[model samples]
Target: MKILVCIKQVPQKDAPLKLNAAGTWIHEDVSYEVNEPDAYALEEALRQKEKHGGEVVVLTAGPARAQQVLREALAKGADRAIHLEDEKFVQLDSANTARAIHAAIAQESFDLIVTGLQSDDFGAAQTGVLLAEILGIPHATIIIGIEKTDTGLRLKRELEAGHYQHIETTMPALLTIQSGINKLRYATLIGIKQAKMKPVRKVTWADVESKISPNLQQIVRLYVPEKQKRTEMMEGPAPEVARKVVDYLRTAARVI
Candidate 1:
């Protein structure tokens, strides 16, 4: 089994964020880390490889800083890494991002492809589904568990309200993994040293530019909401106060 895990680098959860001067996006001069959910996806892929005896390849599309996540994946036991280097990746919507990923790996023969349920930054939750559609493969989202069967693969999907459904699908399938599917392994000292020697193939934007389409969506503005406080006091008879409160809610607050 050759499993490919798609990971992404995102701003650290607690990092302070500021919108750029143009108000088009967040400033990029902040700390970044492997997207939390994508880490779980990588962990699941490593477990699958350990059980099935095959190679686990980590893939990511981003600027140079994105290599950090790939290196981390290599240190955790991925056989190799593929870096889709492009500065524009930071602005591309999920559709164009999926198209670039497909262009990079479409020639490779992978039995299974895995990605996080959604990216931490965009939270669009559409890349894996779009990738599956671009590749013409079966896919399942919010997968909580996976099992290898003699005929194909069995997957446990998470549904709303704590429900789960199990389904079987053939190989060459794409899956968007939910976090906490398994325990994440730390990189041992030896693994860290070995990762430096692992192969990291780079695919430049020029290689896939033709395949990528213009972003279907773009951020128009990003800004923190202003905080405001207001107080309303009503002093009257019981019936009058109740009516006034209802009117305030219905007209001023517009919450009724």
Candidate 2:
């Protein structure tokens, strides 16, 4: 089983965000780390490799700083890595991002491809699905468990209201893993030393420009959400106050 886990580097969870002058994305001064969900995906891949005796390769598309995520994945247990390096890739829409990724891996053969459910920054859950569409392979999302089957694979997928569904599919498929499916493992000192020796292939934007699709989406503006507060007090008898509360719930809060 050859598994490819797609990882991403995003702003650290607690990093303060400041909009750029153009109001189109955050400043580059904040620290970054491997995306949380991607960590789970990598861990799941590592587990699969340990059990099935196969290679676990990781891939990421971003600027040079993005290599940090690949390095972390490698340190954890990935056999090798692929980095689509370019500043332009950082702003690409989900579709083009998927196209670039597909272009990069067009010649590679893998039994499965795994990715996080969505990016932490953009929260766009479309890239993995778009990649699956481009690859024309079986794809599943929110996968929690994976087991090898005689013919293919059995997967446990999450559903709303704390529900889960089991599915079966053949090889050469893709899946977007939800977070908390597995506990993440930290890179050991030995693994960190070994990761420095691991192979990390860097593919520049110019290398795959011809294969990339034109952008289908645009970001007109990006800004942080504003914070606001409001309060209202009711003064009257208990009965009147209770009636006011009910009316407020039915009108303003709309819980009823």
What would the TM-scores of all predictions be?
0.92, 0.91
* Predicted candidate 2 versus true structure: per-residue lDDT over 11-121, tens digit per residue: 999999998999888899999998888899999999999998899999999999999988888888899999999999988999888988998898899999999999998
Q: Write the per-residue lDDT of candidate 1 for residues 1-256, one digit (tens) a residue.
A: 9999999999999999998899998889999999999999999999999898999999999999999999889998999999998888788999999999999997898999999999999999999999999999999999999999998999999999989999999999999999999999999999999999999999999999999887789888887999898777899899999999999899988999
How high a TM-score does candidate 1 get?
0.92
Residue pairs whose backbone atoms clash in candidate 2: none
Q: Which stretches of candidate 2 lie over 4 Å from their true place?
A: 231-256
lDDT of model 2, residue 29: 98
